[model samples]
Target chain A: MKGLLPRLIKRILGGIVMILVVASFTFFLIHLIPGNPVEAKLMQLETAGVTPLRAQIEVQAMYGFLPHQPLDIQYIHYIWQILHLNLGQSITYAGVSVTHLLLEAMPWTVITVTSGIIVSFVVGILTGVIIAVYRDRGISNALTLFSTFLHGIPQLILALLLAFLFTTIWPIFPFGSPYDAVLTPGFTLPFIGSLIWHAVLPVAAYAISSYGGWALTMKSSVISVLGDDFILASELRGLKPRIRIGYIARNAILPLFTTLTLSIGFMFGGSVFIEEIFDYRGLGYMLITAVGNLDYPLMAGSFLIITVAVIVANIIADFVYTAIDPRIRT
Target chain B: MSAKLTDRSQQDFGLSPEVACQVRDLNVTYRVDGRELSALREVSLDIRQGQITAVIGESGSGKSTLALALMNAVSSPGRIASGRVTYRGLGEVTGMRGEELRRIRGKAISMVFQASQNSMNPLTRIGAQLLDLARSHDLPNPRAVLREAGDLASRMSLDADRVLTSYQHQLSGGMRQRVGIIFGLVLKPEILLMDEPTTALDVLSQSSVLEIVRSIQRERQLTTVLITHDMGVVAELADRVVVLYAGRVVEEASTAELLRHPRHPYTRSLIQAIPRLTGDPGDAKALEGQPPSLASVPNQGCVFRERCPYRMDVCETILPSFRFDGDGEHRFACHYEEARHD
Candidate 1:
């Protein structure tokens, strides 16, 4: 128990360090983008015919958009404000708090991406096992070829293809947003049904796009694990096929868990093309808008949330994996 | 249960032969890089009931292949090309399939692999692994299986609860080996196949494990097929010995007879290579050159001709068939059988 507590503390500290690294990198990268919030707002004002120089000065003062401080100082300030849950107001969506914007979009992104990852993980792992079991057979080869094909097609291309099939060809599911605007926002059947109906294409696109990689990873890892001495011993024991698979998967699934967690982390932030192609108002959609308008506050806020989500997911995976594989417990 | 009862009745009537398993002209071959390599060549041997028969050979000598063949658990690319491995009255294992083969495997015949410690599932707890094995064989009561396993552990002088509950990584190598042996023996198998169980252990642990195995074999009257290269280990535990060279049985005799009067030259060289603690150090002669590769072994001659000191002209063209020494039990595949018996 004493040894375990220290290790647990160390793992959490490692996760925090990872998040800090991600946050710092995103902060610098966002700053490196061409224009500031002041310049963006000034252009918007100028596009409306009157160049409000005084209004730009007030906007700069309010948003801390002026280049009075160095990049590192601004980063430290940004981190400090983030620590206090103050992500500042967005320049892209006027009068909207970046924190508020994130909170609103977070549910949609989390629901779709989290669901996609879970579905993909389950399906991929099962298919991987089937592939491994029948590795020498034609079916295994055909499935492997198909998965490789799926993995090769770019995410944007996959989303567009899926959108075309579901929206244009079949016209079975809605594609514009998370739900129909006519549906009342409540815990009612119609609202939930419409939400799912609208989420189908986007979620399917994300799930199908990533499932192949997981399947291939699992198949290869399981194949290697099948050669392990323990697996051979299990065969000698004349264990039933299901029991044998259970033992094989127990060992084979450890390395895959690391990738599974990483996918969960990446999916939360990297579903940019999926959201845009679907016209879904998720965090990925907001991030695209923030990047387009140079909304540093909004971009940093969304990136920080994603960084935290990924790090936390990985840390949880570490804990769960250690618990499952006794070799790793120590 | 019916099989166990029948075995007990046969022993009671004194009709059950001593032979626990019979191997007739068994040939195991491995296909590597589109070439068929003979791993075991027409290897015929018997595992006597209630005795330790050690198949002593160096690496790639097909000793492990013989062990796998006995269980009919030989993996793909390596197969039992010809001949039969009969598990006494259980029928031909080579011809058996599915449940028929599986029933005899873990229940009647169990094996302890080389470096058997690595053969344990690291992800599983020791107790769970034991329970799973026991339950797979249709041991109805989990508690009874645990109790029986605990009894076996204590009999082996291991801490029953501690060894059972701990994971594979948590145990020492010796403990792991002991667990593996216990796993092999837990179902009360009539025949046990141990493939270098003590080769990787320290001297103390090695001797202790061997001692425990010997005692267990004696108490249970278990037939054990021990595969090892260590002559000292063979001398210590084996009742009878079969010496293999390039996947062929070079010699077979009672351990005492073979050690005293080794008929085959390869067997003689192997015995000479053992460094005696009290004997003259000058007597320790290491065999020259590498052990023959399966792919390159000449099909029509003595496999040991390249290394044999007394290689005759006939040894190159004709493979020496087994020539028996008076009693017929002691046999050697060498043309110069009567040249020297001392």
Candidate 2:
């Protein structure tokens, strides 16, 4: 296990490098967009009768630098600010810290997206194992076909279809917003129930859309595991059904853990349409809004947060991978 | 159908050592693309108790198939088409399944696979897997099983603690193979089936492993069935040798008798094919062509006549059944007379 220490440190270093590349790439790509969002903000403020000098100061202060400055200098300053954990201020929302805004939205996205992914992954893996074990049986074939079919449907369609079924046909769970807006944001059962109530469709959409791949990956993994000499050896040794199955599962499940942990990291940003369809005010909602308004700080902050989360998750996947497969210890 | 043949071979071969396991009229076939390819045809043989019986053949001769048939464990794609394999006390093993079959498998009869190096679950330690095997058979006191495994590993010249703790990949080819033997013997099984146990190892490792198997079988008096293509291994370890050709037993006798007087043309060629250290190099006749493929094996005729030099018109017209000769324990299937030799 001590072999993991150097490998862990190496993975973490690699992840940090990936984050840096993603951050810089996002920075330049945002600036490449035509028309300055800062000037637009300045014009809007001027129309609202703010003094011209005050507007200039407001643009500089919120943007951290004027757009006309040397691009390389602006890049260095931006990187420096990032190094100190400063994401500047939101251009769309005057005087709002971009980090604070993103932090507020993170929990909602995490609640829905993480729950959806976990539910899909767990259920899908179990289904895959079942299908693989009963591969010769009719039930196994039917489930495999059904799961692959479900897997083909896009997330947007899944969300819409679920929304239609729940909102019109069933009309049980609430459709829009994370919870009943009037319910104060607290830990009370009613508020929490309403929160869960709103997420059902979105979660269903994410889970249904992604679960098939997990099931297929798991099925193939389990099948390959079943074919290994060790599994047959276990059977030949006359290990009981329970013990044999345990060995199959232990080996089969190792490859899935990295994918599981990595997905956990990526889903923190949530998916755009599902969040938008529900108007859940999660990170994806903020992301779509930022792009629509050309809000540089919000967009940049969102991208950086997602990049960091994924990189951290990737490092975790390496740790999890090494923990299970002894062959990969070094 | 083949019981009469076994009895004839028994009478021909004088020794009356106890029969440890009996395989009668065993025909195993593999289906590929809807074609039934025969792997073993009416293969019958008796494994003597407290002795090593070597089943010898080339690849595709179904020597391994016979080993699997003894346990009624022929893998899928290949099935025991029709056969009766009976252990001494277990009655008909072919009739056993599920818990009873499983209980008899590792407890009464254990097998060492062809690639014993790759036969272990790589994730678990050897010690843990040994315990798992113990628990599966409901062997009481799991710790005792671990202790026994450690002892067996030590007996095989493996460092007990290091071997038990190391994963399969951590062990060398020779060490992992010894661990495989440990798993087989840890149950203290009555019958041990080793399927080409040394095929996957290097030459040095092969000799070492064969030595271990020899020492172990002698120490425990374990009734062992050794499936191999190498006659050298048979010479080194086996007490009795059975020659198989195209999925049928072509010859059977004590190791010394068979080597001295091989009656079957295929057996004689096989014996002559071995390169000798002292004799002239040109005298060693190589086995021409190959053993018959499953589908290519003729349904009616001598199986080895195509590659056999002493071929006659009768061999193609009628399959030669087992024929007795001097010292009743020695028997062979051939249309040729016993006077034939290199």
Candidate 3:
């Protein structure tokens, strides 16, 4: 226990340093984008035939967008607002706080992305194990060829193809939106079922696009691990084939865990086009709306969330490595 | 279990055999690009109980192929086409499923291969690996088994704690080979298959490992089949020697008898090639030319006819059969039996 305390403290400090770095970079990048929210709003008002001078005055009062204010003072104010959890109001959502809008959409994005990743991981790894065990066989060769072909195709193209088949030709799955208009957002079985039904096409698109890469990676890992001496030693030691394969797979799959975690973090950024295609009200949709309206606060908030998620996912992967492989614990 | 009972019944039908392992007409073929390349051709030998039987040959002479066939560890593209590898205790069980074969491996018959450094798990500690082996074989009281394993390590003149805790990557080649040998013998297996076990080690380490193996084999009365290309190792450890050339058993005799009077030209050349410690180095006769390729071997004669210095038309036309000398135990597959010399 005594030995563990210092290590735990060091890990906590490390995490804090990582989070701050992510947050600062996110702030700088958002600030670097061309045009501020107040300027865009003033430009919009002028386009609508409002007096330019009056529109400028109103925008200044709304956002404190003084042209002479020092950049450091503006950055200080931004940091203060973030510290207070004041994410500011969404321009497109009429008076909804950016935090509230993001919170409301979080569960839907999580549900689709998490389910897709989990299913793909399990199926892909199993198929890869089969391929590695039966290497050079007709079935393994066929799977390898097909997976390579699928992986070479762009994810967006795959999604569009899936949508064409499922939505246009089959007419089995709902085309867009995450729920029916009649079902309210309460804990009702019918509402949950409607949401799942609407999510099927997009989820399938995500899983199908990702599984080919995962399978290829896993198959290569299994093949390399099979070459390790321990595998042959285990066989010579009279271990059953099932047990031997399982032992090797456990060790071989370690790198995949790290890859999966990092990919999960990046999944938030990847959902933009898919969410738009499905018309889902997730953070990706919010990000698109913010970019369209030049809503700086909402855009900054979504970017910050994504950056933090990626860093945290990496840290989690490190922790998992120590847990699974004792050699890494030190 | 039923098969074991049947083997016991067979033993009861006849008196217990003196030989630990008997290979009768063993043939192994590898299908390379749809062509059957005979790796071992009608090889026959016997490993006596409580003695080391060395199969000495040059590279590509089917020494390792015989080892894999005996162990039933032949992978894809290579298979034991026809043979009876009958164990004295286990009886005749060939072409068994992997699971059934595994039941006999590491228990009744264990093996140590040439690449001992790569034969151990790098991720696992030595103690953990030993415990895994012990548990798999259902050794009683695993903690005690591990303790005994540690004791065994010390008995082999290794640092107990270091060997128990260190991974394979942390140890030297000699240390890993020592651990491998101990790993095989600790199970008290009836037969131990050693495939060029000392070939990868340095001279000092090689003799040390050989000494350890010799002492353990003597103490345990273990039957060992050692495969090597070195005649010196054959002289030191082998009670009986089987010489192979181009996948065929060219000669077989007691180590003393074969080393004294080699009948086949290949055997005679191999013995002559061994550099003497005291004799004039210039006088030693080294065998010239390489062994023939298995893919395009001749259909009608001895495989070694191309390489034999005293080859005749009869040697190229008719394959030689195994003929016993005056002593029935000493056998040679050569047309020129009259050319024998001591």
The most accurate candidate by DockQ is 2
Q: A1-330 in candidate 2: lDDT tens per residue?
A: 885677778888887788778778977886766766767778888899999888777766676655667888878877877777778788667689888898888777778887898899889999999999899999999999999999898778888888778888989878777888799999899999988888888888888888998999999999999999988889889988898888899899898886787667545544778888777788888888888877888888888877776677667676778778988873
Clashing pairs in 3: none
In candidate 1, stretches whose alpha carbon ends up further than 4 angstroms from where it belongs are A1-81, B1-16, B155-157, B338-342
What would the per-residue lDDT of candidate 1 be over residues B1-342, giving only the tens digit for each residue? 787747743442222377777888999999999988999999988778799999999999999999999998888989899998876656677998887777677788899988688888887778888888877787778667778889888977799999888989998888888888888888888889999998778988889879988998999999999999999999999999999999999999999999998989899989999998997998899999889888888899889999888988888998988888758989998876644443
Residue B180 Cα positional deviation in candidate 3, in Å, after optimal superposition: 2.3
What TM-score would you report for chain A in candidate 3?
0.86
lDDT of 1 at B200: 70
**TM-score ranking, best first:** 2, 1, 3
lDDT of 3 at B169: 67
lDDT of 2 by residue, B140-221 (tens): 7989998999888877778999988889989888788778878888888989999998877777878887887788788999
In model 3 chain A, where is the ten-residue run with the lowest total lDDT?
A59-68
Q: Which stretches of candidate 3 lie over 4 Å from their true place?
A: A1-67, A76-88, A134-153, A161-198, A227-229, A326-330, B1-16, B122-125, B138-144, B165-167, B272-286, B296-298, B340-342
CAPRI level of candidate 2 = medium
C-alpha positional error of residue A298 in candidate 2 after TM-score superposition, expressed in Å? 1.2
Q: Per-residue lDDT of B289-322 in model 3, one digit per residue for the tens?
A: 8887778667678888887888887888899888
Per-model TM-score (chain A alone):
0.85, 0.90, 0.86
Q: Write down the TM-score for model 1.
A: 0.90
Write down the C-alpha DockQ for each prediction.
0.64, 0.75, 0.45
TM-score of 2: 0.92
Worst 10 residues of 3 chain B by lDDT: B7-16
- Candidate 1, residue B93: the lDDT equals 79
